[model samples]
Target: MYHDCTQVLDSDATTYPDDPPVELAPHTTFEKDGYRVTELGFGTHSGTHIDAPSHTEPDGRTLDSFPIETFVFDAVLVDCRGKAAREPIDRTDLPKSTGGDLLVFHTGWDAHWGTDAYFDHPYLSAEAARWCADNGYHVAIDALNVDPTPTEGAGDVSGNAKDKPEGVPAHHALLGTDHLIVENLTNLDGLPEQFTLDAFPLSVSDADGSPVRAVAEFQP
Candidate 1:
């Protein structure tokens, strides 16, 4: 069976504050051109997307630099649900054995999509991220970011890792190790513990990141 874990990309889609919002305009109508053509505009990291090392690390590898096969990964779901807002998912929250190369953290935060609470969803601790990186596991999460996303309210601290304010240590820990990150993933609750993740980014030249049609495949 195949399950689509990607979020829909429309005008109402949640986007990073600093990124361009999604736009869809009628370029040609059926009445005039006998066919419809819509013009699309959105940032690379607009919706359910993958982030390359260059997204944070200077002089790091871009999405296009990776081989096509890199998009498909054996993934294991990590259930980190019931966490409070702005809480950190520490190393203790992870299982000792994943049996996969990708760790898909299910925070159940997708339930708050399109709301302010979504930004306050649980985030991965830098130690947890480093643990995954050290074990050569890529990371994916059902939240805005692996690190805490500071909103208008509450504290801005992500985790107990040092260098908290200078940069997103969780991002640095994973990306600095050349591990890719997938964000805004949904429908993880419907998936089994193990599945095949197929999320291919756009082939844009020197792309830092790109929206993906992330899918999960597994036996029913």
Candidate 2:
């Protein structure tokens, strides 16, 4: 069975501060043209998306740097639910051994999507992120960011000048190397611990990141 783990991108979709929101316009209508086509406009990191190394590292690899097969992963899902708002998921929360190349965290924060509380979802600690990177495990989370997102009036969306770790420590730790990070995943309630993840990003040249249709497959 296959499960869709991607979030829907629409006008009401939650987005990071300053990032562009989803925009749709009718390019052609049945009454105006023979065919109907809609114009789409949004940032690369709009919804369920992958963050390539270039997103944090200026000279790091982008989405176009890897082969298509790289997007497919043998995944392990980590249940980190019931966590407090803006809490950090430490190394202790992660499994030491996993027969997979990817680690997906189910934070249960996707239930708060499109709300201010979603920004306060649980995040991965810098130590945990580095652990994953060192262990050669790609990471994904069912939250807005792998790092803590700033509150509306707390600071900028990048989490500058806040109680949290300065800058994006989780991002730099993981993306600083060759690993990838996927964020804003949804519909992970009943997935098996082990599964196959197919999350292919758009093939954009020198792209920092791109939206992905992340999917999970496993035998019932």
Candidate 3:
């Protein structure tokens, strides 16, 4: 069966404070034009989205640079429930024998989707980021970021890894290695330990990121 792991986008969707406000004005209404069309507008990273390497790296690959096959993969869920704010998920905590190219973190932070609490939820340890890079895994998180949010408490710093005082290094870590990063995911709790993931980003030329309709397929 196929499960929609994507977060439903609407007016109340949570977003980074810096992102543009989402707008869905009617371009044409059935009453006036006998058709329905919307003028959609939002930031590249506005909703459940993917971050390409160019999101941080100066000469990194953009969304259109990678082959479409890179977005679809087998996946394993990493349970991080009850992990504390800014808590780093060490590489040691990851599954020893994961079954796929994607590793998704289920932190249960989607519970706090529209509040300040969501922004400060647990993040991936710097080591975990490097682990994904080293192992060639596509990573997705239910939290606002794979790393810490601005103003959140610092977690365990990786050895000599330059820690950003106001940001987590996961973005730079994954993007720097040409790894993919998906954020603001929801409905991950219903997923099994292993599944099929098809996360395709918009083919926006030269863009750094795009909202994705992430889905999970698995046998029931």
Question: Where does model 1 exceed 4 Å of error?
Answer: 156-166
lDDT for 23 (candidate 2): 88
Candidate 1 per-residue lDDT, tens place, 94-148, comes to 9887588999999999998998778877888889999999999999999999987
TM-score between model 3 and native: 0.90
**In candidate 2, which residue pairs clash?**
none
**Cα lDDT for residue 146, model 3?**
87
Query: How many residue pairs clash (N, CA or C atoms closer than 3 angstroms) in each of the candidate models, in the order given?
Result: 0, 0, 0
Candidate 2, residues 1-220, lDDT tens digits: the string is 9999999988899998789989888999999898899999999898999999989898989889888999999999999996777778999999977678999999999999999878878898999999999999999999999997766544443354454545899999999988999999999999999999999998888888999999999999
Cα deviation of 93 in candidate 3 (Å)? 1.9
TM-scores of all candidate predictions against the true structure: 0.94, 0.94, 0.90
Residue pairs in candidate 3 whose N, alpha carbon or C atoms collide under 3 angstroms: none
Cα RMSD for candidates in order: 2.6, 2.7, 3.7
By lDDT, rank the candidates, best first: 2, 1, 3
Question: Which of the two candidates, 1 or 3, achieves a greater TM-score against the reference?
Answer: 1
